[model samples]
Target: MSNELDTLLTALYVDLEDRVLPSLGWSRTHRRGRRPALGDAELLCLAVAQQLLGVASERHWIRYARAHLTGMFPQLPGQSGYGKRLRAAGPLIAAVITELARDVDSWHDVLRLVDSTPLPCAASRETVRRSDLAGHAGYGYCASHSRYFWGFRLYLICTA
Candidate 1:
């Protein structure tokens, strides 16, 4: 049987071996030893992949990661762990993505089309109060209503 998580991990590792591992310092010393840090690609893949599984917030990411993602990407630590790794790799990931979007000799930037509608509080209006305006129930926008209100929206953004 093939495990999706294991397969993905193997592919990711292969990528690192080819692109990243060769460029970094991977030594096992007896001193302080290496920190339990997720690689840049690992963190980014975890973040983006969890988002696909319907996780949005950092806390949610942590929880879901512990429950699902970690099972998929065991390198994913707690929420703090994932956040730290992701944050550390933000710049490097951005540069890698930017470079990947372009060819060796491309003068023009590429483009991608992305659109999403805010599914604000479509729930019972009575259920929403000034104090109830917390989280998704809080300030959200109504795309169908073409107005900015308060509530939760499916937040997902990807750069092309």
Candidate 2:
């Protein structure tokens, strides 16, 4: 593997192992909160490995595990279990991602691209009728877009 790829993998694995796994103390030893069947570390590692391999969607993720992750992980957890594990760790995962900052030395020091995107919060018809954005969802109105979009506006940060 290239040095960059190796560094990223090592950083990701170590971050998952040390920072992400410990916060998921949702379950009790006496099973008060109900333990996730899969270990937190295994689930995170498997999901990240899938993401690194560019596998999206839960079904294809299972196929990826059957092909690549199975040999690496003796547990080789099932798709359903993986889904549950991911759900349990969702907030922590997002927090970890948000906390990660770019390493300036690792950067190219050339042109930088900073952008934004729409992260819609389910603006379906019924959703519109029930949401605070109901009045805002229509033609020619988006506070964030500053223009007409057929859907509700969203805000997110992007960087490259």
Best of the candidates, lDDT: 2
Please provide, for model 1 over 1-160, each residue's C-alpha lDDT reduced to its tens digit, 9 standing for 90 to 100.
1377557656755665466534543322423647565654566566556655676788876776676555546665776766776776776666555544453454363554466666556455565654445544566556577677655666555543
List where candidate 1 sits over 4 angstroms from the true fold: 1-13, 20-33, 103-160
Clash number by candidate, in order: 8, 0
How high is the CA lDDT of each candidate model? 0.59, 0.60
Q: What is the lDDT of residue 5 in candidate 1?
A: 53
Instruction: Tell me the spans in candidate 2 whose CA falls farther than 4 Å from its real position.
Output: 1-11, 19-37, 102-160
Q: Give the per-residue lDDT of model 2 (tens digit) for 1-160.
A: 2466446656776766675544434223645566654555556667677777787888888876677545446676677777777887788667655445333443435655554444464445676567776666554455566754445434554343
Estimate TM-scores for all models: 0.45, 0.48
Candidate 2: lDDT of 46?
Answer: 71
Q: Give the C-alpha lDDT of model 1.
A: 0.59
The lowest-lDDT stretch of 10 consecutive residues in candidate 1 is 22-31
